[model samples]
Target: MPLSEYEQRVLEQMERQLSSDDPRLANTLKHRGRRSVGRYVAAGLGAVVGLLMLVFGTAESMPVLGVIGFVVMFAAVAFAFANPHSHEGPQGVVEEDGTVRPAGPGASAKGARAPRSGKQPKAHKPGFMDRLEERWDHRREDGR
Candidate 1:
């Protein structure tokens, strides 16, 4: 069912909070709205335009122009298919009990990774962020 205006506003508020708190997590969980009838209309119109171009260009022996028009029409259909509505809910949240819960509409356990209990292992390899931070830290220490 379509959401009521009040419900939509509540959702928007919650989303704004999450996005502000952790942009990376919010991006991972982002949901664009569903493709509507308007998109179908646009696809139909694009097909009609492509058909006209093919008919006219073929008559003038302009095969390349006709191909270009057909490509545009295909792109329009591809766009419609790509814009699916997200049934996905929020991302996982850390609970007060020191457990992680998946961010469904209602809270649910999605299991957690076992906490590491042994002595810290040496780094196998440093990642790009690690290298960058290391470089900056070194530069600061050198008063550069």
Candidate 2:
């Protein structure tokens, strides 16, 4: 879930304080958001392969194959989740004011910066739940 405005402010305040107090630690914490499409694809493929292995192993009465399949599936999921966000971004590090700075010295800083989002966009557009929530929020705002 996304943080509320108040919560977000508090978090940013905390970050600013941290950066001020410990530059090294703040630098360590500065990172890009995770959104790896390739990793997701690999994980999905691995899961399917694992499932086939599991089914065949069981049918063929090979406990080892079943175990391997289970391992592969587990590993695939683990691998997917373990992967972090790509480091490549126009904004390499966030500043004390929460604005992003150019990732590299070579990157141009002439244009206005794009707004950053906490969450990455998904392959599919917003689904039913998202629309329902939007409507609900609108109704609440309208005091209906």
Candidate 3:
């Protein structure tokens, strides 16, 4: 379910408090919002160059050049896949420095807590029935 107005306000307040408390963390969070297009362009160029190298190497009968081209192609693909903005899925926990850490108990390496905001956000655990209901609701919405 969506957060109520009060919950939204509380979350915003918490975010502001966190940003003020740790500027570095805030900077990292801000950086995650968008990615530069130049990186994608460079990756594309790398792939094209690698393809050309592969074709030319094959035509020239140069086995070493063909291997190098394969390596280049692999590296380009790896680089593209490694781009942070390319990730599209459920996110994990936000670490102290705003980097994403895997979700689990005590997954935080720095053991950082939220800055003092005079109020701790209550953690809500959804019951099994509630979770089932939510899934059912989602399925209905999706016309499943």
Candidate 4:
């Protein structure tokens, strides 16, 4: 079904707005929805190879090779599903917590993200081994 003239105009306006907001992301998205035939072909080929390896390993009673084949199969499936090109670009600010956010014109010059919470990270206490070491040091100091 074809979109009406009004709908078309609205869609075009939205596209223009998106491109203006973030041109880099817009370009990445404009190419495609990020899925390609080449990716599927690679994954399929990997799966086939892994299956053959697994069968051969089982026939030969090589458990290690079988395990490796399983791992390869798992890796191929993971590669197929994974999106390597996420929207996060070089200009995005990576927060301490690992979240990427777009940088605005008035973004911080220092590039250091200020903690949102007023409380700072607490100082860690020494573990049991450290306490034992401290005790040993104290005994040596007293003997000296």
Candidate 5:
């Protein structure tokens, strides 16, 4: 169920309070939603280059080059995956009882946003599956 306007305001206020109280904790709570495609592409290319280098080195009887290629590939893959901004969710944010809540609505989950313009972005309409789920939930709530 969607939050009422008052509930949403309260949540926003709490978030703001949390941020003010512990900026570090608030920053840590924020999720980095997704990574760019370029990172994956570079990693793939690096792997392919490494494989080609390994094959060529073997054919030409060069062990040193093969080792270098392997190192390069490993470094590239590590660099791509080790980015701090790639993390998601609320794994570190702990409650008073040592429980973590999944980042919910209004939670600071930063990712790519559409460029701002004079016009507001169109709201997404619920799909057939979503409507069906809503109906099912309503029925369950009514003790059907």
Candidate 6:
């Protein structure tokens, strides 16, 4: 359900206060929104297609489309299922019994894994055409 105007106002006030104090808390709040409806549709379509394939007994060829649908539906369902909205105050990090901690020096919780070592490096290989495209992009960005 959508928030009422009054609820929205309250939410906005809370968000502003939270954001002003700790930007990270604000960032987390920014992501709260309704889940995509497309996911449920995709999942339903996939199940139907898979069922049709089964009924037709064309398991070899016709089943491919059904399998594809299933994959798409699974992806959509996964996205929908992985909701980040929580009652937890910020960063989804909460103390036992669910209280938000104020941000401060040494505020970080223990046992958090250090950021992973460099898993990706910039690629240095750009062909002539790629460089030209990059230059074009830069020109557009510069409005020149």
Superpose all Cα atoms of candidate 6 onto the true structure and report the RMSD in Å to 1 decimal: 22.0
Distance (Å) between predicted and true CA of 110, model 5?
18
Against the hidden reference, what TM-scores do the models get?
0.35, 0.44, 0.42, 0.47, 0.40, 0.28
Best by TM-score: 4
Which residue pairs overlap in candidate 6's backbone? none
- Candidate 3 stretches with Cα past 4 Å from truth are 1-33, 85-124, 127-130, 133-144
Cα lDDT tens digits, model 4, 1-144, are: 999999999999878876865566676587555577788789888888888889989999998888888888888888887765434358686643365866655444334345556778746656445778999999999999
Q: Write the per-residue lDDT of candidate 2 for residues 1-144, one digit (tens) a residue.
A: 999999999999988877766666676567433445787899999999999999999999999999999999999999887735233445575543355656655443433344456856546655445778999999999995
Runs of candidate 6 exceeding 4 Å displacement:
1-13, 34-36, 50-73, 82-144
lDDT of the structure predicted as candidate 5: 0.70
Each candidate's number of clashing pairs is 0, 1, 0, 0, 0, 0
TM-score, candidate 5, is 0.40
Per-residue lDDT of candidate 6, residues 28-49 (tens digit): 5665554456755666676666
Give the TM-score ranking, best first.
4, 2, 3, 5, 1, 6
Tens digits of lDDT, candidate 5, 55-112? 8888899999898888878977886786543344356334433455455443545432
Sliding window of 10 residues with minimal summed lDDT for model 1: 105-114
Residue 128 alpha-carbon offset, candidate 1, angstroms: 40
lDDT of 2 at 82: 76
CA shift of 105, model 1, Å: 22
